[model samples]
Target: MSHANAALTPRHRLRIARLIVDEGWTVVAAAHMFNVSWPTANRWAQRYAAMGVAGMDDRSSRPHRSPNKTDQQLVRKIVHLRWKKRLGPVAIGGKLGLSASTVHAVLVRCRLNKLHHVDVRTGEVIRRYEHATPGAMIHVDVKKLGKIPDGGGSRYVGRQQGNLNIRATAGRPKNNKRGRVAGITFVHTVIDDHSRIAYAEVHANETADTAVGVLRRAVSWFAARGVTVERVLSDNGPAYVSHLWRDACNELGIKPKRTRPYRPQTNGKIERFHRTLADGWAFGKFYNTDSARNNALPGWLHEYNHHRPHTAIGNRPPMSRLTNVPGQYN
Candidate 1:
């Protein structure tokens, strides 16, 4: 028999009955030929004699109605809150007065729970830093950044310091008698080792004098927020090893700590800060002049310290982890 006529349908049973009656085939033979049981063949033959092919159709396996199902309105609300408001199921459930599991069930039923919504190129899982107390240690470092081009048609310009104009000279060998390294600008930064609270200052030079000045400003900056400085850690750079730096640390009663030579990981907290600065600010930036780049620093730093959430502090801003002030934490 053909596949369509061999199925458990009215037409199939009629074909089987005709094969058995006209061909003189036994019920066992008809069942074997149709790939069905002898009882099924006999029953179909009886049905074909009484009600014909119309009685051979099989009953559906599905239930006529489902009594238990997720609410459509709740599922719609879950999807809307997730995609529109960017709220997780827990937050959505809290707002809509539903349990998290119920919200999750609705999302799963709607097939909208694990949708890829974030940009894959920029989306990376960053590990959080864990530190409890404030002022246990402080990370200090200087980041050298590329100079921004000044718009006045000149390739090089001078940065003014008080009454002096620190002019940039032509590039020459480091050991050359007349050459000077003036193309780089430095951002001196200090971060609390425990809270990751940061303080930064832009400077034209990375000399010991500039380092000392930035450190002083950093101390004052933290002091304004009721944080005290105990230990300042840095790499073994010449600026950090100078007498001026030591004298300044002594005057301020701050312990000066140095990392091992060639191993920056010893002072990792501030080093990691530099990595964040480069990735979050310096990378992919387009600027016509160095002054413009420098001008943008304050805004970016402000955002990083006060607005940008740090995963290290349970998605709270760095300033929030600094103290127990309201509107700062949580």
Candidate 2:
């Protein structure tokens, strides 16, 4: 029997063997019926007799030993930092005093990198800018928005509660729909150009008085953290164009710079800060009331300053990269 014409089915081979045993068929005749060599026929017959159908299954081809396996303790540490501590490989490496490559290898071994998931609605990431020295320039801006509601909306509101008041329930009230809320509820944020350290305050209005208050608070925040405000850059909004704002800067002995009308890129740092605030903190959250949103601000700011890793700062937190020299702000 030729190998090219062989019938590979286990049932067919078993039937051929049974024919030889029950009907006294010769080995040559059974081999010819199955189109297999006599040795192949005899081998199948012996396997069937010893282990029934289980003997026909193929054996595993994998090797018994892995020579270059990663260290289990190192892998455990990497996974712990990534999952429990929420640290990236670079920071984990810094803490563990390991090279980035070694940390990466451990992360790969523990499947840490594969577990990272991102929200689909997240906006495209903008490139980061880093200033070499603190107080080179600071970016400041205001973000005005509608008030959020209290006790976030449940998914079954329409079906269970039959509440079709989507606009009235989810957003601000109809009477408050004018530019009043838009012009008010401003978030004044100031970010250092070099350290990327940020200080933000939520104001009730975008007036020049509110801007001055924000600038004062921002200057003090940086001063406490040992970063001076040499020059502040802002957009050409009406509040920023007022003499009051310039007078405030003059009082603080700091230079006030304004971006050209309709050109926000000149104050790109604050624009980026706005995007970070919207995307990183506000985008996915549903706050029922303005107070709820405001309440969450401090926590998110803490995370941004102390925990979140910045690739621009060599994967260190903004606060971690800061120098605590007292005279820097003085």
Candidate 3:
């Protein structure tokens, strides 16, 4: 393929070459006529003189020799390890006594970087599918976040403060006979498979009613952005399998689908989003308290949906895929 930002097509280059080589125009005059640099025009003219018309065609820019490139034998060994052991870059690197980055580069070159790209059982490249349109299938899941203690969580604060906060809250909750676990905040998350647009809410629990309510709101959220929800995909969690969830889907006229048991990969999109949520929002920065952390979700969510570039969608924000989003203009 021609470079996306190429200044001239092969036809235009051929014209430049003809002007310089056939018409006997000066390289400077030809470059000025074609609005190209002198070297560009001269190079094409030289190519045409040497190889005739075929030389005007686009050629690969890759160097003929890459001295630093990994050896062919090493590349084959890396590929063999991927197929025979189904190991990730880190694991493969550990076994081969190579740097993880070197192994990772080989894996990327071989197109076996993502686990889903390779079948688990056969170690063969697998074809993965996605919904072709927005809202064709939205993934729903609950991410349980450890609520920051009143004085901040261990992530930001010291473990001593964490234990103190735990001990301080031990007698507060009625069900906690042993107060080892401080508390958990359920973050109901919904993500579109096509655009990777996401919606999330922090709640007290992950009950059937709460899940249904989140689903209802999430549908409305997408609708406001001009996307109609056709289906919902989720794991076999207690809330997802409940009658309330089924009834809610039925009432909303949306199809509900569940991943096969023990196969979290079936709902991989949301799972990956949850990891991003953890890194970008929940643990992105310091929080004086859980309430402070909760207060930051909307702002981060706004940035994620409207400004943050998603690699799956070619480095554009998810909002780029939607219509009539009021925030889109802003």
Candidate 4:
């Protein structure tokens, strides 16, 4: 197929080739008319003579056959062994009397290279889900981050300084400790189930009162943008089960739902958002103090909601999926 920016479309190639073969136009003249090279014109003409117009289309760059490629039966065995035992390439190779590199190549070709794709027990795929509409459900989760040390920690300085910073603050009270520094910051995130639009805040603790407060702010934030929170989903954390949290949900007319006791995937949307938050903001950069990291959350949240493209939603910003209701940051 012709690529978007290709020098010549299939039609152009066919036209040039036809002019040379049927109309007896010289290859050089045809090449000049099409603004292509002599070899290009010659190849197209030969292809057309051999296979007609169809030959003007692009062909696979890959060879017709790879003689050195591992046999299909052998490849299947490697895949079967991988799925059955969840073994690494080296282990599978050893069992099958093949080189580790060869087993890896087979696994790569079969798209069975990633451990996450295979279930350890059943070897079945782990599928994902998304709600149908914005605000149909909101995934709420909390991520605890160790605060950076004063004047920056190991990431900014050296490991020795980081340890010294931690030891220096060991005498401080529990509430005062910063992440890695001495205490921790609990990041409460509420992400729209469909659009993946997220609202996040860093708090001192993940107490029931803190969760309730965060939920109130998140609901108000969504309400301002015209998305009513129908339901809220979260893990079965103590804060989530508290009467304060439930009362807060009732006040907003949002039903509270919890994931199964040990299954966090039921609230996977916010869980995934937490990972993004960590990579893009929390630990994304070095901060001199806990306050600096906390300060970065607002800006990063804005970027995540209004600028960062979400892969699950067709690579458009989460705000784009908000439909008629544009986000506040938008």
- Candidate 1 C-alpha error for residue 158, in Å: 25
Largest lDDT belongs to which candidate?
A: 3
Candidate 1, 196-239: lDDT as tens digits: 88888888789999999998988887777777788888888889
Model 3: per-residue lDDT, tens digit, 220-283?
9888777889999999999999999999999999999999998787788899999999999999
Candidate 4's TM-score reads 0.67
How high a TM-score does candidate 3 get? 0.65
Query: How many angstroms is residue 181 displaced in model 1 relative to the true structure, after the best TM-score fit?
Result: 10
Q: What TM-score against the true fold does each predicted structure earn?
A: 0.51, 0.53, 0.65, 0.67
Assess each prediction's global lDDT (C-alpha) against the native: 0.72, 0.71, 0.86, 0.84
TM-score, candidate 2, is 0.53
Model 3 residue 94 CA deviation in Å: 15
Better of 1 and 3 by TM-score: 3
Q: Give the TM-score of candidate 1.
A: 0.51
Best by TM-score: 4
Error of 1 at 1 (Å): 42
Full ranking by lDDT: 3, 4, 1, 2
